[model samples]
Target: MKKLITATLFATMMAGTAMADTTLKLVEVITSPERTETLKSIVGKFEAENPGTKVEIISLPWGEAFQKFATMVSAGEIPDVMEMPDTWLSLYANNGMLESLEPYLKDWEHTAGMTDRALELGRDVKDTAYMLPYGFYLRAMFYNKKIFAEAGVDGPPKTMDEFVAASEKISKLPGKYGYCLRGGPGGLNGWMMFAATMAGNNEFFNADGTSKFSEPDWVKGIEWVVDLYKKGYAPKDSVNWGFNEIVAGFYTGTCAMLDQDPDALIAISERMDAADYAVVPMPKGPAGKSFPTIGYAGWSMMSASANKDLSWKLIATLEGPEGNIEWNKRIGALPALKAAEKDPFYAGEQFKGWFDELADKDAVPTVMPTYLEEFAFFKDSLAIKTTQEALLGDITPEELAKQWAEYLTAAQQKFLASK
Candidate 1:
């Protein structure tokens, strides 16, 4: 009897070890306190559902995430699952470092409920599903109602000219600027939006695969923003401001207008009263169209993952209708799942601005050239340097535009050649 009991105990111990061996590592690069908390909550549920299967969560600070994640991967310390931003998708997907999620997505119970845009962006790298996008970041104009009223401006600007006029009017007020320009990191989107609006279309490349940024219309768009800074319409110090600074500027009533994605709402709503602010579609330009930049971040499984099925299961749990909605509620992005749109959370007045932009024929959602593997470097380094110079009058808009056109043209052509 003693011998039989010992054998049974050993068998039970081995079975427990087998179950404990299924440990999955997840890294979230867009880390925020709220986002991390919500992620942990969702992951906790995932862990609870799968007994003995542990999920190790790593939250990387957004500022150092790119370089840090690259180093981690190179050092052979790869996570099974990762939060993939659009800018990083091309590099990893093209390098074959990411697992194609098409097969899993095909059989996912909630796959049909994903919006078309979500799937389209997920397949952006090589027309293959390397990531499952959780939400979209659509740019819109956030304006302070109190500032507008104080400046005697009637309402949100509807045209580029009106936007500038309102800015000038607001600038005349003591200690107030018209626009909270994101002139530092992550400013590329604003520059692209203005350039495309003035260029009369959101087309970045011509038939010959050359960038159209150096064209006269696009140059004017660049100049228009440069002039806004030079004329004191925006805070002089804003030339060094980034995401946090601009959001703070808007909520503090130091700036009358800010062009940002829905995520800004999370911060802005916290500081300012609901009645003090509102959002609107980006102002149209001479062609009567506005091109607001749209971006997204999603979940991607690493090709190096030993347990593909388990990794995919984690992705599905996070991106499933309930998990996705909960995540976006904290992240402040539009849900990638179509059914999540019906939730009362999105039906609020604040979200009306983005929904209205979606319905407006003249409001174009401009997607950046994220397919180019070199784009992350260009946006994070090259564009920031040159745009700051342009804003400070250290370089002419024409010079800046020419440099951008050359860089983008080369990148796009190289991408085309690879295909």
Candidate 2:
């Protein structure tokens, strides 16, 4: 009789444990079909491991993500977790929108894997830790192995001088543009057009909380980038080409080199034979240090989430070694995980000739959220046609810089007020 009673009590306890498990309405703003599929698979495993919690991912492209989310945030319909770019973090945080992740980060093992730079980059507009970095992207040179061989160059360039010489060599090719520069497209793809100018100038709004964007050092840098567009090396239509057109140009042999993010590497390799493509570091400038544009992608947990603990558990697995490899593989993104640097997927000739800057432990965060306006001035003043005409001898760089300073002064007032 005692054994029967004990068995009944054990069954009752088991039923209670099952009921405690709950469903979490997780909303992730995934950008692509491939990434959506990858995330779904990752979430599925988490649900299986931790019974009773359902993670529902709400995939949204960059375009649709923001506008739709604005409504949700206003309606108090925030997701359990979501993804965002580090640069936009300020706008959200300043509006009293974001929940501080500092409370949970204090003892989380996965959050511990994050580096100092990662944490710094995730700081809110107020310079407080408000989010966690989930993934990152790096700007690099994508070169055609065939083009390098034809130009009599054995490998990629190491310095500013080597880069200029190589571009000139590639110009000798009958049908190809020497080095490619993007034409502007939508606001979302605008980064490619402005990256070269930003790196060459070492100018990204003032790093010290000032609006010194038109400072002499950065002005000289814009002068150089404008010259590239007017020289006939970068295609005339580049300003309007968009990412698709640029990718098409690289694939069709119209251009010898492209400045783009590493996330495109997987697509580049998959589209053609692996032998057709290789990547290198973005070239150095007057500063004498190789600077490639860098940026962060972030993830955050909602303060109001009923299953907050379970949500972080899912985050841990996704950021952990196994899930990161799977997710990074699908999207061609680099995992912030240090061990991912030496992943076997990055091995062999496919990654060869591109190993020089593979692990950018030295990369600086491309731009903080504050520098958006400053970045705009350079692109309008020099990257696009407004400055292209001046670079081509249509107007002097001196004249261009003069007009640029006026715009910078006006913009600086508003930008500074926010700080």
lDDT of 1 by residue, 365-394 (tens): 989999999888888789989999999889
Say which candidate scores most in lDDT: 1
lDDT of 2: 0.62
Q: How far is each candidate from the true structure, as Cα RMSD in Å?
A: 1.6, 5.9
Per model, how many backbone clashes are there? 0, 3
For model 1, what is the C-alpha lDDT against the true structure? 0.93
- Each prediction's TM-score against the native? 0.96, 0.73
Model 2 misplaced regions, further than 4 Å: 1-30, 63-68, 71-77, 124-127, 151-155, 159-175, 185-210, 241-245, 303-307, 346-355, 358-419
Residue-level lDDT tens digits of model 2 in 1-419: 99999999999888867645566665555476667888889889988898666776877555345557767888988787777666456556656666776766777776656666667777745666666776666667788878878878768776656766777777778876766665452222223223334445444445433434356655555555555566666677765664556767787777778766656665576676667777766666555555555666767666667666776787776767788778877776666677776778867565543355655443332442333444432442243554545545676655655565565555556667776
**In model 1, what is the error at residue 13, expressed in angstroms?**
1.6
